[model samples]
Target chain A: MLETHDTKLTEDSVRQLVREEIQRAFKKDPAKKQACIISSKGTLDWAYPPLILATAAAATGMDVSVFFTFYGLNVIHKDFERKLKVSPVGNPGMPMPVPMPDIVSSLPGMTSMATTMMKSKFANKHVASIRELLDVARESEVKLIACQMTMDVFGYTQDDFIDGVEFGGAAAFLSEARKSHLTLFI
Target chain B: MPDIKEDVVLDARNLLCPMPVVKAGKQIRTLEDGQILKILATDRGSIADFPAWADDTGNELLEWHEEDGTFVFFVRKVEEED
Candidate 1:
């Protein structure tokens, strides 16, 4: 009888331990994970960082929001494909088959050529296109927010953006950023 | 190394950072609890990304190995309790 009573106590303790372990495993709330990013550049090369980071963060199950301000608004603009261009004139770091001086790079059609080369190079490298990244960001529910003040300054309307974009001002971005542990201005 | 039988195979070969993890995250959601996913990727960055991703999502990173130039990863899904 004593042995049976001791066994019952052991079983109860074991069950309690298992229950505690399960609770400990769930201590970190998934909903609390958040990331906020600000995209302030509109160049083709500049566009990738914010979108990539946002999508990756969303994929990791973190709530993500990206604020588009200044020229960055071009990323969410309907004509993003055409508006986003790479200018080699001022960017000497750009690799070229034949190096050209700033004067030559500033010549007509140079930006178009640089942009095309970058697009093809990225394509060859299997890098996701801006459009594809944007699609993934949208599908993953990453919030794309356009700054209302910048929109007004740039004379852009709500209809100028693609679907699923939210419009807000600095305070809106700050409110979200304050709650996020990871905040970046890219 | 013992072979792990995976319930799903995700071919992310030649894809860059974020795509592999992005695709893996998408695929893992389609699996039931305890199901294993096999991912093949060429991006070197995934060597660090996968483990962190698994930790963040509360999934299990069963094992990872480099076969030739390809990085192979096996992950098991862990259901979140609300």
Candidate 2:
């Protein structure tokens, strides 16, 4: 038996519609005034993201903070020349100016050539340097926190880092992270 | 079209996002108390991004326009008293 009547929508359906409308009305929030970036890669390519993001966050007036843990400390260390090195042993896809095999890249002069080429390319395109980004981050008051446990394991003294570095443990990072709406692991 | 003088001109034509803002930030630091900076960018994101950046960083976006398919923005560096 079909009872023909205009079935009114229920309250739950209206509520659900309103809820979806509200959700859709909300915009994607930007990164917080504070951020925590965990740097673990010592390579030049892997280093750029953290620095770029940190500097950009600061430029956006966020209380940006980067926590250097493990290999991440190399980016902010005093002896970054030796601290940050790229090994071509396992890298099969690293671009070479010429078609050079893995053995050639492992040669003494090839890495330096590659590094120089990368730096020049970045400069030609007006990309900021790692050091420049670091400076901007520092100048903008971005807190550079060095992870203490990682430092102990890596045998890095407090003096091994540049100025404006704060040494902290995981708890310290967490405290900063709690207040931040933006937390990144790079 | 008459050449409207920009208080400052930041030529970020081929540069990327973070670089443009990063350089602009440095340039802004060097300007006088109420000087302005005009940024030219090819990165499409900069059109929207710079305004938010200006607001967040306490700068003021005075005016913006399109020129030769590039985005030109005029920002006044806020004299932050801290």
Candidate 3:
């Protein structure tokens, strides 16, 4: 026999209870904050997100690692300064202090000019440089991994990369990725 | 006028948010305990950023000031006592 009482849990009350339970559950099963960033492109803009996010993650006291594969190796390579270049021919989202028409943006040499302007703006606005971000990552002990398979494909030797970079592959990344609560492919 | 170290001058002029703090974070670790760092930055956000960073990282904010165009910050490396 089932006795149905005239009782109803209000939506707000139910929500509160659920939130409390979730909080308690999370506290009990505390997850480690780990992130894996896979950088596949060699562009200047493409370089920023991984470095920024990795550094910010380290700032948040998380275990962060970056896996540079293919063209991404240029970012952490010794010749990065010369290898990395901004190309306006394809980048539409690149901001300009003064708005320019697509034609102007698509024009030759616009990328170099735009790159210079953006770098200067970054400097003027106190935006951290890629070099500085890398230094921060290093200081914070963020692990940097260069994809071994990609290195072989690209014919990059160990000397091609900056110091303190480890060589690994997808399996290595997945091993870390499985433990991480946050994983990003950029 | 803040204490200056032989090798720890951070020229953050024309840089912005995370950049200033990021640079300061990197440079601060290189300095030994009690060594001072002078940060010359144009990023206005650093007025507040460095103080917060100092607190979080256990470094000491010795002094800070702004002049005609640049903001100056002085921080002392406080060793993270084991």
By lDDT, is 1 or 2 better?
1
Residue B41 in candidate 3, Cα distance off native in Å = 11
Better of 1 and 2 by DockQ: 1
TM-score of each: 0.88, 0.73, 0.64
With a 3 Å backbone cut-off (N, CA, C), the pairs that clash in candidate 3 are A123-B14, A123-B15, A124-B14, A125-B15, A125-B16, A126-B15, A126-B16, A127-B16, A128-B19
Per-residue lDDT for B1-82 in model 1, tens only? Answer: 6489999999999999889999999999999999999999999999999999999898999999999999999999999866
DockQ winner, 1 or 3: 1
- N/CA/C clash count, model 2: 2
- Report clashes for each candidate as comma-separated counts: 0, 2, 9
Provide the lowest-lDDT 10-residue window in model 3 chain B.
Answer: B1-10
Question: Positional deviation of A34 in candidate 1, in angstroms?
Answer: 0.5
Summarize candidate 3's per-residue lDDT along A99-173 as a digit string, tens digits: 777787888888778778767877765567788888888888889999998899888999888888999989999
How far is A8's C-alpha from truth in model 1 (Å)? 28
Report residue A116 deviation for candidate 2 (angstroms): 2.1
Model 1 chain A poorest 10 in a row by lDDT: A23-32
Q: Give each model's whole-structure lDDT.
A: 0.93, 0.78, 0.79
Q: What is the interface RMSD of candidate 2, in Å?
A: 2.0
Error of 2 at A126 (Å): 2.5
The best candidate in terms of lDDT: 1
Q: What tens digits encode model 2's per-residue C-alpha lDDT throughout A18-69? A: 7877754532233345677777777777788988888887767677888888
Give a tens-digit lDDT track for model 1, residues A142-167. Answer: 99999999899889999999899999
For all the models shown, what interface RMSD does each have? 0.5, 2.0, 3.0
